[model samples]
Each structure stands twice: as C-alpha cells, then as structure tokens.
Target: MIGLILAIILFNFIAFKTNRRHTQNSILHIWLFTIAFQLIFDTMIEFKYHGYWYFDKEVDWLGLLAHTLLIPPVNMIFLNWYPLQGRLRSRILYTLIWVAAIMGYELLTLLPEPWGYFHYGWWNLWYAAILDPFLFYILIKFYRWIRSLEERI
Candidate 1:
C-alpha cells in the first residue's frame, strides 16, 4: 500500500519533470493503446479466467488502479526511447531491456502478499516474462505505424 503509492508518486514526478508529453495527440494515442491492453488483460487474468487478481488494503478501486495508473507511463517510456529504425541487433537489445524491466516489476508485485497488489491463481512469473517481449514488440510496431501515418500527413 505505502510502497505502491510511493512508487506511483515517484513515477509521476519523473514523468512530470521530464515533460514527456511533447504532443498531446501522441500521448493520447499511446495512452489509448496502453489502457486498452491493460484493461483487457487485467479483466481476463483477474476476473474472467481467474488466473490472477489484484488486491489493496483499502479499496477495490485501488486494486484496479494497479494496471491503469502504472502502465501508461511505462509504455510511454518504452515508446519514447524505442529504436524506431535501428538494426536488428539494436531492436532486439532494446526489446530485451524493456521486457526485462517489465518482468522485474511484475515479479516485485509478489512481495510477501499483503504489501503486494497481485495474487496469482494459475498465472506465474514465467508467463509474464515470456509475454512481455511480444507485447512490447506489438506496441513498438504500432508506434512506428502511427508515426509513419503522421509523417504522411
């Protein structure tokens, strides 16, 4: 609880300090994709499939927020530094770094139950570790496609 809020505050502060939203349209597009992905995956894993669920000490809203609030800035950071036209090796390295970070964070949520927001039923860290790279690659490709369209206009 304390840790999660502090992390969010710290992340938002960095995002604010960096002024990463150079274009409102671009931010909106990224946020749309991020929120959509979070909601869909969260709903499936947490609610529908019962693979995992979130919990907070205070309220249910706080639980859902684990996905919504934390994910966009992460996606933004990933999209922002992504090598758009790099060589295959560079792209692979970049993807690996982001995926590793995502997996690391997800694993952190398993910190001794009460302080953590996530509880797994069938889902495991390995699933997250594997899926993160594919998810990031899709998002990066979507970002590039959007940028190309913007250039056309």
Candidate 2:
C-alpha cells in the first residue's frame, strides 16, 4: 500500500510537471475528482470490512492522496492520446472510451488474487460496477461545463 501510494505520487508529479503548460487546471480538477471518489470508496470499504475507518492510518491517507493526484495524469494521458475534440458526438464517444478504459483498469484488480489496493469481493465489485458508469457520466458533464466556461471566458 505504501509502495502504491509512492508510485502514484511520483507519477502524478511527473504528469503535472510535464503538462503544466497546456491544461494544469483541468488536470488538477480531474485529480481532485479522482481523489474524492477514492476517499468515498475507501470509506465504504473500511466501513464494510473493518467496521470503522479513520485517516489516522498514515499509509492509507498517503495512498488516498496519491491516488487522487494520479488520476488527472492518467486521464489526461488518455485524452491526449485519443485526442477528443469537435462535435457533441465525438465528445460522447470520447467520454465512453474513457469510461471503458477506467472500467478496464478496475477489472484488472479482479484478475488473479484480489489486488490489495482494491478489496476484491462481491459488494466492492458491484459497487465499482455501478459507480464507474455514474462517475464517468458526471465527469463527462463536468468536462463539458468546464469547456463551455473556458469558451465564454
């Protein structure tokens, strides 16, 4: 868990530094959203398993923070590589593609033994299955709103 947190932080730092010129705020927002989701998910997992949860766990806190920071870079990379631009149709397509990619990553946690980062169980799996699509939709809408605001500015 510590290692994962460190890795995520390192990756986020690298991504942020590399992309500082083009879309820092957008990427930051993505990172914030990702982190927020992770926190909520983490809380749910802890409540289900441990019966209680606290951020006093240094490693868990670090992991959550790192995961949040890492999200922007990961999503930014996806968007840049795929180049989502132009019409509403294209935007929807791009958003779906991102949703698919996020789901793919989440599914990877299920392969073999449950990856320690994400608890692998029926409830967690179901939660993720439901959560990902909703989150993706919200994210897409948020992105659209941000874009519109940028245009107006």
CA lDDT, every model vs. true structure? 0.74, 0.56
Candidate 1, 1-153: lDDT as tens digits = 765676677666665567543366677777788888878877777777778777733337777566667777777777766777689899889988877877777777777655566678888888888888888878887877777777788
Clashing pairs in 2: none
Where model 1 places Cα greater than 4 Å from the true spot, the runs are 19-22, 56-59
Worst 10 residues of 1 by lDDT: 14-23
Model 1 has a clash total of 0
lDDT of 2 by residue, 91-127 (tens): 6677667667666765544344323344443354455
Best model per lDDT: 1
Index of the highest-TM-score prediction = 1
For residue 93, give model 2's deviation from the true position in Å: 5.2
Query: What is the Cα-based lDDT of residue 136 in candidate 1?
Result: 88
lDDT of 2 at 32: 73
